[model samples]
Target chain A: MEDNQIKNNSNESQKASANYDVVIIGGGPAGSTAAIYAARSGLKTLVVDKGLTSGALGITSKIVNYPGIVEEISGAQLVEKMREQAKLFGAEYISDKVIGVDLQSETKSIFGNGGVYNSRFVIISTGSMGRGVRIQGEDRLLGHGVSYCATCDAAFYRNKDVVVAGNTDEAIEEALFLTKYANQVYFLSQTERLAAPQELVETLKNHPKVILYAGTKLKEIIGENRVEAVLAVQSDQHEVLLSVSGAFVYLQGGRPVTDFIQGQLEVSQSGCLIVDSSFQTSIPGVYAIGDVLCTHVKQVVVSAAEGAIAAMAIEKEINGRSRMMVDWSEKKQ
Target chain B: MNSVIHVNDDQFEEVVLKAELPVLVDFWAPWCGPCRMVAPLLDKIASEYSGKIIVAKVNTDENSQWAVNYRVQGIPTMLFISKGQVVKTQVGALSESGLKNLVNDFLAGKN
Candidate 1:
């Protein structure tokens, strides 16, 4: 009976999902710009973003160099403005983290944490804040003990020791979650003090199951098959090894965000997505822009310009046009 | 015609370990992001490879007993069991082709 209910519910949800003409990932300058151009061109567009501050522009304190905006503005506020503009142009924005994608099929399917979206075109503008380097044995023990998601794997480590590395709020929240299942939770922050909110930090510090290790660098993950221990350096001299069954690493690095693609698309040597002059990737109907490009200039105007190019290219492809459409002419006035 | 069975702690032995064919058991929950990503793929495999293999899902949120017994320290942990013995394990989301390759390898005894 329950199985039938589940199947029916899944089918209903799948039916509820509306097919879109374009699905843009990341709502930063590039993604929002793409949404604006695509939606204004009468194409049904949807933008899926993790959050306001998920991209580099989101974390930027002040963006004064952006053209047409004389006032000093925060990256988050600027992004919000772009998002609003895109929405005004008929783009639907949803706050959801894209977990995976299947771009080979005619209708590309983007899987998010909340729901799935199907579209004719996909834009890759997730930026360069993705993790690039892996500690020793981290890759080998990925399924065994090394995991990026704590919520997914924390339950499996019941009564076992685990380590949560990183200083972000996400890492702290995961560490706190692990306390419920794991016998002990070791919180390792590379910084002297975590940049996350103070209340969350205090809670993690005061938690009975947590052992806080600040200003530590994770040197390596020591294990044969699964995670047996973690080798870390404290204060640049002291080496600490903690026995653990799991290692939840939320570390961030400066590389193109392509993990979600799962090696289906082409990337450059530095892990940046390779795109043509039109911002179209190696795969047809797929586009990439902004900081995800290796030669990308990390500027708001640059990203926005790239987004415009990609969106126009997408519009051209969708309409089967040999020449690109120039919309600068006064709109039939 | 059998889809992926939502096997519980009690039915695990009979429905999976003692199944007629090898079973690809997925330890998952609704809240897990990667688990959500693997769900649709598992459904397709369950239907397409019905007689060749059994795709069993153990929702760890409710049925943690078997998951604990298997020492599955990850969600979406696919344990390939042949003849009631664990043969292979994959612990995260894979691309569509990646999943297909893993399934083919599991069926080919190369896992």
Candidate 2:
């Protein structure tokens, strides 16, 4: 027993040595499954995620089709169970929004809002919830007055009017952050109601600095060299132009979250990430799974299965083995 | 034999505006995701161009004087300056190839 204890201690130390073996982006079902398998096989694993509700599953009210569980549970609960399992198997989870990755080198670097993480393998499971298209003039004047990050550029608009666009909780949170610096914060929600908690929505409506514009769509950002104004359309087809110094857009769409890649990997014409049978992308060490793939079925079971396959494949590649060693049973007879 | 130089408001004039080589001034901040996305590309440019052009970074969070002077309202805003004048201004992140093309064009005296 003492010998076994010493061996386990040494193994833990080895896993915690210099760098991680695998870093999974997004803590959804697919990413968590990958982490669970990798960690169970004695590899260092780290999962970076925005939050439980950032993915499509996060917003799902009920999940009835997940295997083995007959009772209906919320999507977030199922994700939580997977996360718990992964953590139990020695996977580290951090709540950070991943913005970019450097996958060209041997040691891939993943940058997030909190810090930068490096690993030998990277798994792209940041499920599709990204903005598919850019608004008019948004591309041209991106750095002038049309900004995306409120924390980074809010100081640039001190005592100036700004418009925050979107309906997600992320948009509301950023708009609230901008209220501290900007004189007037006009929130334009494409939907009539904000997709956030009731308490947070009430706070936004009550904030004196915030002006709620529900059921309004942002048509164009009118600017030449810098952001001058924004033209928005209401549900009644009424046009309203608001003169602001900055336009902070936090809009989300039904697309893969690969824009931060910046043409680093191969992608399909429809913006889906291309991967081999083992879920490995064009880059040898990088892998993508889940809804990010156009050929993938939008089901939790399929994503989890893909995650398992990718983890096993990575294990084989790292160990220089011809075939993967499947873990069928864990009972020590 | 060169790396990206982090210029401050005090050293803006000597480092970026009055430099002998063409300057690619990157206005960035750490908290911004887009700024972080373009960082590696700038690092590559700084080493590849070396003495031909200078890749300078200005952290708007720390030094806002130069950012304000250039009327920068967004993170990762790049200013292509030549002969101590603003040649062009680009907002947001660009792909590796796009950035390389931009640098090449700037070196060949294209705005």
Name the candidate that leads on lDDT: 1
Best by TM-score: 2
**CAPRI rating of model 1:** acceptable
Model 1 ranges with Cα > 4 A deviation: A1-18, A40-44, A58-64, A69-77, A87-95, A157-162, A168-187, A192-214, A222-231, A239-245, A266-274, A316-333, B47-50
Q: Give the TM-score of candidate 1.
A: 0.79
Write down the C-alpha DockQ for each prediction: 0.39, 0.48
Model 1: per-residue Cα lDDT at residue A235 = 87
TM-score, per-candidate, Cα-based: 0.79, 0.85
| lDDT tens digits by residue: candidate 1, B51-76 | 99999999987898987787677778
Per-residue CA lDDT of model 1 for A234-265, tens digit only, reads 98779999999999987878877878889878
- Evaluated on chain A only, model 2 obtains a TM-score of 0.82
- List clashing residue pairs in candidate 2: none
